[model samples]
Target: MKQPEIIFILRGATGAEHLALEGAVNLEARLSDPDRRRALVAGFYGFHADAEYCLAPWLEPVEGLDFAARRRLPRIGADLVALGGKPAPSRERPTVTSLGYALGLFYVLEGSSLGGRVIHKQLSHTDVDQRGLSFFDPYGDQTGAQWRAFIAVLDREHAAGRADSKEIVAGALDGFRLARMWLTE
Candidate 1:
């Protein structure tokens, strides 16, 4: 966790995007009910898919495709973030997260086997979570002592290949852009 603090200066992994996700997850868990907390997580994802940082025009190549068709969430997440679309923030839950967790999880949950799987493998190696759902939501293993290791693994992953390629990084950028729009608005 401390390692990424410096890297945050170079990129979004540890910047406002990371903070937003952490804030949302922390807030969701604090909510009065468990079910509502889960739904709030979903809305966070919905809002994140529509953020301007997504720069929909940049994703012209894979606009109609899934980040990872094999995974249920990323596949469905693709269309909801259509070109020229903005987040609706249209959920009926008692509380709404600022999309912090949603953005944070984008590191792993938003893409195809190429990048997403890298994070997924890290999560597996660390043994913190087996579900691959993510610590992005308050409902998952986002909290507690174990999360430390999970986050540490993320830092390691980011530090190793923070900017390996342009397209991969750009895809990640969209998730954060959506997160900022969802929260501040």
Candidate 2:
């Protein structure tokens, strides 16, 4: 039998965690309040910082993938500050020991941009100041193309035997867990 695509595998394995995280984020409630918005951005800063640090070693060397440009920690931090919050002095780092695991983690991070686009649209209708909204729409008009590029890289890696679907799914689950924990805390 032919194997399922890695993206499909990741989406299936991470479906529950992703839903839980979305519920915890409660974008409508959070976006309605300035304090809540700052807190949300701060939580994202913390999670992205740790996630990026974990992914660097594994993803940085991947050709055709500009991992450095994909880093969101800095933009998240800027968003937090713009929203009148500060980054935590430290955060718990998730362990990502393999390329497959890193790709799994990245799948979660990159996939978030899809939701971010929706959140960005929601925020547009809110009274919240727009300065910190950069995190929600980092790619602007290029979001689809950027996502396709990442997916291409993922497919290439899997086809080349550099990553395993199971490990990638596990990484995605962990990523969702980590994101939910930080966001809800």
Candidate 1 weakest ten by summed lDDT: 93-102
For residues 10-86, what per-residue lDDT tens digits would candidate 1 score against the true structure? 26543555466545554423223444433443555565444322323322233232223213335324333432223
- lDDT for model 2, on a 0 to 1 scale? 0.84
Q: lDDT by residue for model 2 over 9-105, one digit each (tens)? A: 7777788888889887887777767888788888888889999998999999999889999888888887887888988755678888889989998
Backbone clash total, candidate 2 = 0
Candidate 2, pairs of clashing residues: none
The model with the greatest lDDT is 2
- Supply candidate 1's per-residue lDDT for 80: 30
Candidate 1, which segments miss by more than 4 Å at Cα?
Answer: 1-14, 27-32, 44-66, 74-174, 180-185
Backbone clash pairs in model 1 (N, Cα, C under 3 Å; residues 3+ apart or in different chains), count: 7
